[model samples]
Target: MGNNFKMIAKTLFGFEELLAKELRNLGAGNVKEGVRNVAFEGDLGFMYKANLCLRTAIKIIKPIQSFPVRNENDLYRKIYHMDWFEYLSVDTTFAIDATVKSDNFSHSLYVSQKTKDAIVDKFRDTDGKRPNVDVKHPDLRINVHIHKETCNVSLDSSGSSLHHRGYRISTNIAPINEVLAAGLLLLSGWDGQCDFLDPMCGSGTMLTEAAMIACNIPANINRKGFAFEKWTDFDEALYEKIIAASLKKTREFHHMIIGMDKAPSAIRKAQENIDNANLTDYITLKRANFFKTTKETEGPLHMVFNPPYGERLDRSDLDSDFDVEEFYANIGDTLKQEYPGTNAWFITSNLHALKFVGLRPSRKIKVFNSHLESRLVKYEMYEGSKKAKFQKS
Candidate 1:
């Protein structure tokens, strides 16, 4: 109970509940879900923990002020009167990031410009100097979010997208996003109980995330830094303590995690990334066509992968005749014929090609892969045969 404040953890579409659950598990109070975001209550130490451990969150923002605004002038007037000295100094570089969902504020860029102007003007009049604006790298990143008539201004606690986990030194052309990979694993009910596989694991994102989940490691443990570290009130000793505590909670994972790719280059990149994450001990990578492989492990298997979506794969990968339909059909054939007792899930935006997989998905969850509207489809290969599936279905 040390100066608790409300904060918003933003995420991809359809991940609000997951983020909310993560917050509650992390001891956040008053947890609530919103569209693509979750609001919760926590103090500064908890903020550090959230940034370090939240697997589904992209960015967390701490709201500093809120008010009603009709036009840009109202925004400027309101922003100018705030006591900026508390959070920012004349020597500190800052940036404004604005998102508007209102008819009053037509363009977000305009809103950002106006807010920057107000803040700089305030400093110029008061202290006879102004902080410079740095978009790429800034000491203080301000966030302005407007919905209808109310404007909410906040501090961006996570600078870049938390998906930059600092371990991906090399990647394939169609590398899956780290945050999306982690969320997909969570949604697939992958709790690291059984053996895990990513058959078409291009850059081994799913494999790495699976190992982290299995080991109970912090999601961003490999991440270099968070924005809060640059804040004026950042406590270095407290952050170190939090890191040590999180690492202490990590438990031993007994199950195997595997990644397979057809391309040699992909295997090489995945090996580099896994090594960078210090997960080479927990993950195994092989260069093999997934359709040619069978279930090599015993017991139930958890499989999640991002297959070639017909768009982003390397040119060499798609240089052949590359029949999209037959490619997916082979996927179904292999899964149905080879792998059993596996809860196999994969995401794709190519709906037309997805239908060619033949087998109907047991669960289809709508999601977004960056800008593409995608579906994370699950096809459960029963340990038993047609009788068991028919009864369950």
Candidate 2:
């Protein structure tokens, strides 16, 4: 790992462990899990691979400098004194994203302004011009993080959140974030071993992510572009090699991946997204209420989905004219009576409605679906003559 440099993969809350494990599995050195982020060491190629493969990572950043700062002036002076010529030029367009958690710096925007001023001032002093600030489509996106008295500066390797997987041109009312979808599948132990189903498959995100995981495909294979592509030292040939190598590792997935939604519009949207992902062959979409359908496959089935919890999806819009509590009860009844020999999992932000399910969850994990605090609960339905016992939550 002599040629390795440290990189940070930012993730959502409760997904740090998954991202760190992914980094280690991808042959990262010195992997460490942080709050909503993971720090690891890898070379340029590995960095690219990490961006392409890390399912739970939101963004990847490369820190360039760390220093102590007493105030805004100290921050500007320290940033100005750095060798900005190595990373940026007058011809490059740049943007600064700041995060401040300190009494010294209360406003993150002000910190970003100071950091930008310092970098531009440095360029102006040496060269005759300075880089222009382009927040939307910057050639280089710099990160400024102030933690109390210390400041850390980094380059954003990922231009946007990894959730923009370049697929899913269509979405339903409440589409789940791609990273959160992938993380939920991983946490459910959905290794593509058996048939998979996302019963309330809104936009087919869970199904798409499940198929990708089953085939070991790179997470960001459909991404538009990374920030590193616009960097000064990007190696095009090495990146091409990395892409080829990652694609070559994809394995065959024989098990069926199924998605069902009652609404015809959602079904159409899901199909469009599945087609966009080029995964129409691996996944099948149907317009049917989950309560009316039974397990189609013979073997043990794996299920993961984000159902309408009455919080996002209005109850009247659903096919059934049942209230939220009644809807949850029906879900519990369906899984218990119709879908036997299946491991079902779903996330719901409606905490009160959870108790109406009546079925105890085999496992429960605390996760966040956007700003709403949610719980991903698992229920294992028994097979054959065996009886499955579960503890009530």
lDDT of 1 by residue, 1-393 (tens): 869999999999998989999999999999999998999999999999999999999999999999999999999999999999999999999999999999888999999999999999999999999999999989999999999999999999999999998899998776788999999999999998999999988877889999999998999999988999999999999999999999999999898999999889889988998999999999988889999999999999999999865565655767577788888989988888888888899999888887788787889999999888998999988876651452211
Give candidate 1 regions above 4 Å deviation: 312-317, 387-393
- TM-score for model 2? 0.97
Clash tally, candidates in order: 0, 0
State in Å the error of residue 345, model 1: 0.7
The local distance difference test score of model 1 is 0.91
Candidate 2 lDDT score relative to the true structure? 0.91
- What tens-digit string does per-residue lDDT give for candidate 2 at 15-119? 999998999899999999999999999999998999999999999999999999989999999999999899888999999999999999899999999999999
